[model samples]
Target: MGPSRPERARREAVAKVRDQILASLLSGRYRPGEKAPSVRRMAALTGRSRRSVHEAYRQLAAEGLLEVRWGSGTFFAETHPLALAPETSAPPPALPAIPLELRRLAERLELGEAGLARLVAYWAGYARDHVELAVVECNGEQRGLMARELGETLGVRCREIDLAELGPAGARLRRVSAIVTSCCHRDEVAPFAEAAGRPLFTVSMDPGFLPPLLDALARGPLVMIVRDRAYGPVLSRFLETLRLPPEQIARLAVVEPDGLIGALAERDRPGALYVSPLVRDRVGRLDLDGWRELEPRRFVARDEVDHLWAHLAWLRARAQP
Candidate 1:
């Protein structure tokens, strides 16, 4: 039998409740092993019925975002924060002025005008002052590299933590402006995207996983790094699915192993990559000479992922009349 409209609404309400709870955990408002508000309390907080909150929490606990002890109470997962990169040594840099080319490109993408408006408003808040950034990596070495990069470029404190060690702490979560995951798998990346209300960037080993991951991390910025040529066609197709314009696509920079050092060496950018031991030993041996490497961080860190965010921020700031 077909479901009734009220039932659908109730289901949606429950989903929203779950999303909010997850967001709270990602924001570090809730701590791992820390009891969440009672269902009765959450119902009052979200203005939903107790049954709705109960259903939501039950689902979340099943998903491993929360733990429920028969008599102890509900608590956030101890490792929830580990889903993202650790905090950087300092806060993110001051938001920069939105670029005009990006604004025009975003307008052409035709994201629903209302959605675009809301995005712009959000960027404005970040631009008003410094936003916090959290970077999560799989190992200590990567964390150290990220910390050093962030410290030099953003000139703010950056926290470095392994995702495997994160505990429940909502306070720490809320401070993250963005989450960057390096050399991560698709399975590991999705939950963090869902958990963190912010955007995500990944250094991907598999090109096939990039499209869906990009779609899933739709809330804010998402930058994907591809290391193989076989993945290029796949990425091109994915961009087409998103209807990205040719001119926009042209802006992507391809990196060749032979030319990578030279390319990066020429760019005196603040966050340029140096010859890390890992890259030198692994990918540097490839025959890359002119393959495009998508430097998503450059765009995302500048306050936009695709043209959409850039344009929205510009229009919103301009519309402040």
Candidate 2:
């Protein structure tokens, strides 16, 4: 009457892979008629198996979202049904690129061409220094991705540190010029920053997190797996800002990483399973059968990054010899 466990697992793996590609498509990362990455490339990128990725691509082809060529790689459909309509109240365009902003500031300071070049070089060197900024997160994968994205956005080489490992990072922690983290993690991270005597800045959680949140609620009861007890309250506070109804809130459960496998076993039909950044690695290691591990993409918000840029500029001004 029901699908076998392995069959269900295959379906779930395919669905999760499909969602990843769909997100990239919706975000305009892959434009119409653009060549999509090959199965091998995608498997490597997502750290998923080749079979899962191939199944996902085949499913998308059936849905008219992708075109697969025998010799050539897969390509995004020229006219897909999932075309996103422009938003009427879309947010304002981001502030000019960081380099452009720096150039403008140089002009305002009345620097000549040579002086401007020197200023640019100085800032570039400082930003590219690996010890300049430390990015903290509970999950290793999320931490690395977040740090890499922020570093690219700000032209900085960030030091990635796990929240749990902060205690052991004595000299490395002290060497960094500043520390940054998701606003949702500020509480847990603040104590570390305070102890290290380092200034802390928080970037707002990316809006991309909303899609997965809504999808999880619509599915049924939801269970969130987090790394430690500290994240429970912190995540709760962040969720409050979203204004979820009390009924929907009641449908959610926050469990520690250790409890995840046991919790799943207890439920005959588990609803949407969400993993916080801290526990992502743990979830990946578990044999979830068909259960999908939904985690939001780690992205740096432009406005927050601009605020970070301002702070870095001020520090540079004060540090001038």
Candidate 3:
């Protein structure tokens, strides 16, 4: 009784497009009073449908972040809204904006108000039967972080598993109510997602990913000080997002500053040494006078996590058992 597969997929797509637009605005790519790019241009930039882009712009306009002018295109508003009217101050509408397809199906079935309410309750019960979420990730470190993030955000039980652990066409995946992952692993995890027939959602980097990471990268070539060797691959992936090649970014596996200093003493590499929080704290205590340690320890963005939370809320509210 949960949302049909196509219904869920479309909503996810729209939500992602909307989030991407918000990310651009929050990242300062489109400033206040600036003419936002055309809907077609945004669709191409984000690799989403033009309809989705227009829908996102419409949503933003309603929220006062954007203004849509006929023939003039959309523009970022001069003043952003600080807060929306409280829910208690407004009367609830009799019907929410259900999808057209869903509405047609309901009409064909001739479902009355009471019948439709029962139908929703039945789906909610169906969703409740499988409450555990499976977070598909490429590496252990990424998986652990994804699980913790989603668990805290969604207030649901979440466990980390690699694509291999998902087991194509198996019982293990069937128990999961949803599948969530980092934006990077979406392709690798898609097949298993189909095999499991569960909803899949991707989390993105927050607007915060730019300033700290970009500022640090501008000062590269950086030597990464990994907290654990297992985190090397994920960190390496993040580094590749920079303009430089992989070889320019080096790593020192030890979690201590003295080890970093000793390693550096033996090498003649250029640029700064970027330490993870675990190592950064310890580095502050040591006197490695020549080494420049960058302070962008954690790179996850607020809006990035917001997308994953929005996906979870969709499942609970619209795809509920």
- How big is the RMSD of model 3? 17.3
lDDT tens readout by residue for model 2, 72-162: 8788888643342333222221222445556666576554444344444444544553336899987654466567667766767688887
lDDT of every model, 2 decimals: 0.47, 0.65, 0.56
Top candidate by lDDT: 2
lDDT of 3 by residue, 134-227 (tens): 8776665556656655554444577677666666535666667677777777887777777666778787655654455445545544455644
Q: What is the TM-score of each candidate against the true structure?
A: 0.30, 0.44, 0.46
Query: Cα lDDT of model 1 overall?
Result: 0.47
lDDT score, candidate 2: 0.65
Which segments of candidate 2 are over 4 A away from where they belong? 1-125, 134-175, 179-200, 255-257, 275-282, 285-295, 310-321
Ranking by lDDT: 2, 3, 1
Where does candidate 2 clash, by residue pair? none
Q: List where candidate 3 sits over 4 angstroms from the true fold.
A: 1-131, 168-170, 210-214, 217-221, 227-242, 245-247, 250-299, 314-321
Pick out the ten consecutive residues of candidate 3 with the lowest summed lDDT: 81-90
